[model samples]
Target: MTATIPAQTGGDLPAHNITISEFGAMKALAILSQSGKENAGVRVFIKSGGCSGYQYGMAIDDRELDGDTIVHDRGVKLLVDRMSLPLLRGSEVDFVENMMGGGFTVHNPNATSSCGCGHSFRTDGAQSPDGEGSGGCGSH
Candidate 1:
């Protein structure tokens, strides 16, 4: 695996080759607003599992590391880890709300294959962080 740090600039906004849609940006804003303060931002990671290969892992964190890729969209601040930043670049994260369904979804162009649940995917030879790149979903 190529260890790549997300490219950066001295400009006000960080440089990004990724595309984050306005709709998704708004949804992320709402989530940040609802989440209690002190949370750093959202942490999106890759874990192994699902029918595809890798699953996404998201969590609210108040702590941030230096050099993390920070993006300001809508009303929220998002920080992507240096390692995961490259993988998530151009990926859009949005909150889906409905009478019967409400959750987060990622539209990642990097994913070559994704499970029907859309929670997992696989790319080139990357290993899953969910533990052995299988996420224990095979028995499920």
Candidate 2:
């Protein structure tokens, strides 16, 4: 079960999108249910300045913005704002477990280079702010 939410066009909003795997969908549902909020959902976004030029941010939210792309899957809603959609388009949200632990992982196809941690990534040849190494979620 794979699903994608594409940002709307012809509006004063940004256009970006994201996909989710079955595992990710189920995990989102579980998390939301545990939060005890009837309208709780996950908000995924991108912020500037990581080890890479951009970084991912996520949190459980109950409010919906004016220009949010909502992906409904497995009884869970994943929200992506207009400004953050473009950077996340074609990316996949997944959940995995390892000896270290488990969490949601985003497989972004737009990434040109990523760090060893798989949390932060670069899409173009953009350099880090310090002109040294980039940092973020990890890498992909």
Candidate 3:
């Protein structure tokens, strides 16, 4: 089941939204159950660093902060902070499996360029402060 969390309108905030795939929901649920965190939500955020200037991060969290947007889709809840929402707008979270492994990946529309490993990305107007190049794919 694929569903989108509606974007918040008005004010200076940019229209931001996110989606979760059926496979992603299933995997998240299983992980939550296995980790005894069934009541927790998946927190998705972006931080400085990485080869592309910004990197994605996720974790299981039960506490909702002051500026968090809680999104429910396919029985999974996503917690996205205000700072990361704009950059992650129009993004989709999905689970993919290959010969190497299986994991959750983000398909970000705001990203103009992403590293080969997909863990880091750069937006059109954003640049890495360190001026790094996408040298090679690294383990997550």
Question: Which candidate tops lDDT?
Answer: 3
Q: What is the C-alpha lDDT of each candidate?
A: 0.61, 0.71, 0.77
| Candidate 3 residue lDDT tens string, 25-98 | 89998887777764798889998767787889989897788878877777888889988988888787888998
In model 1, the worst 10-residue window by lDDT is 1-10
Which candidate number maximizes TM-score?
3
Off by over 4 Å in 1: 1-20, 98-100, 125-140
Q: For model 2, how does the per-residue alpha-carbon lDDT over 1-140 read when each residue is reduced to its tens digit?
A: 22345433233423244656788878888888899887988888877655666667788998788888787645667888888777787677788888999888788988897765666677887776455344344332
Winner by TM-score between candidate 2 and candidate 1: 2
C-alpha RMSD in Å of predicted model 3 compared with the true structure: 5.8
Better TM-score candidate (1, 3): 3
TM-score for candidate 1: 0.67
Flag regions of model 3 displaced more than 4 Å. Answer: 1-14, 130-136
Candidate 3, position 51, lDDT: 74
Clashing pairs in 3: none
Q: Where is the poorest 10-residue window by lDDT in model 3?
A: 1-10
Compose the digit string of candidate 1's lDDT tens values, residues 39-118. 55666665546656666777776666676666655445566766677667667777777696878778887887766667
For residue 34, model 1's alpha carbon misses the true position, in angstroms, by: 3.0
Candidate structures ordered by lDDT, highest first: 3, 2, 1
